[model samples]
Target: MSAAGIGELREGPLHAAVKDLLAVPGDRAEVRVEGFVIDLVRADGELVEIQTGGFSPLGRKLDALLDGNRMRIVFPVPAERRIIRIDDHGEVLSARRSPLKGSALDVFDRLVSFPSLIAHPNLVVEVLLCKEDHVRAPEAGRSRSGRRRRDPGERRLVEVLDSVTLDSPQACGALLPEALGAGAEAEGFTTRELAAALGVRMILAQRIAYCLRAMEVLEDAGRRGRAPLHRRA
Candidate 1:
């Protein structure tokens, strides 16, 4: 289903590409209210915004729109990515798949930039796992003083593989990996313990801990040296 006015304004290709998948029947897109243009308004009157970039740009818009409004933030994290390099003449040169993989925990990297927004009562965050195509101009860089000045490449939306929603504290709690099993999460754990158990660095474990804490899914248990102790609430 297509939303009215969605195609009227020029939005990024990825933004426009995602609209068709998310908008249901009777949903309005690019709707203007009180001089602000909202991304979409669902049949249930839920405000939906797809942000592919940083949250710093959303503060003013969200503050105005979120008051007494049920809003959902749809964020896409690339699970699999393929790179397509093209020549200046737009000729396809080469295509290759990237080795890096993404998981739901990756959202914390972006979420950490603006963690406070996740705690909003009227907000629901939907993390989408997607496969994307990164289009690049392979021979586009220029040399200046033995330095490479590169043109910014582009990304295209390929597909959304799967999704998970965090609508409440408990929902956020559910994202904890099996490494932190029910007993472990409930029994309290130190960052060292979490890092050692997950085979991750202490810094990574700390970021994960911060995300859970901001979401109200985890709380302080105590401290183990510089690392903080936490338990699932």
Candidate 2:
């Protein structure tokens, strides 16, 4: 990216790094085709879109892209995060790694945002697990030597430590605490039970439930009190 075009790119360091990694043997970046700017286009015309956010926002863009291209959407998960803070005086404040790490299961959080899109034959969801460095700028109005409440406030990607892929729905089974049954499924589970089973937060479990349900990995089996129950589909 050039100095003038730097602002034109919507993605951050993680995205750009993954794009380079995903650029296949004969793929090209920033290709203009049919008046649309594609991320990467393979020699055989397959397109790749690296999305690190929710899929719901890309509905219209996908609609346009899929009309003519067989595409794949790559999502990067911060499996490990390291924080680096900088003060207004351009001094490095602190560097620390987050104790709690993310996993393949974390993809469920974004998948719940637009579940049906993954069902498209022309589109595949690729999850990339990555170690990252987050750089933050100091919050405004604080004295150079004074202690601040939040410290550096605005955070952005400064580097990518490493990244690897978990491609296809089959590969994502590692995220589940238990395997989904093959048949119409005899027993069902709720978000609460799932949270307890996985030893994760209830809110995260809810998102995982939504993704599994959408993927046809789980089926709705009425409700347990106010929450919905799901069985293997």
Give me the candidate number with maximum lDDT.
1
State the weakest 10-residue window (summed lDDT) of model 2. Answer: 177-186
Give stretches of model 2 more than 4 Å off: 1-7, 139-174, 179-186
Candidate 1, poorest ten consecutive residues by summed lDDT:
1-10
- Residue lDDT tens for model 1, 1-233: 23345444546667777877898889988877556667888988888888777656667777887777898888877789888888989898999998877766666666676565777788888888889887888865557676676645666789999998977666766766665736635667887777777656677678778877887778887765775678876
Clashes of 1: 0
* lDDT tens digits, residue span 1-233, model 2: 54225424676766677787778788878776665666788899888777777777667768787766788778777777778778778689888997867766776787777665666667777766677676776545546788554653423444444443444444445566544332333557777877887777889988877776776777788886897788766
**Candidate 2: residue 94 Cα off by (Å):** 1.0
| lDDT for each candidate structure | 0.75, 0.69
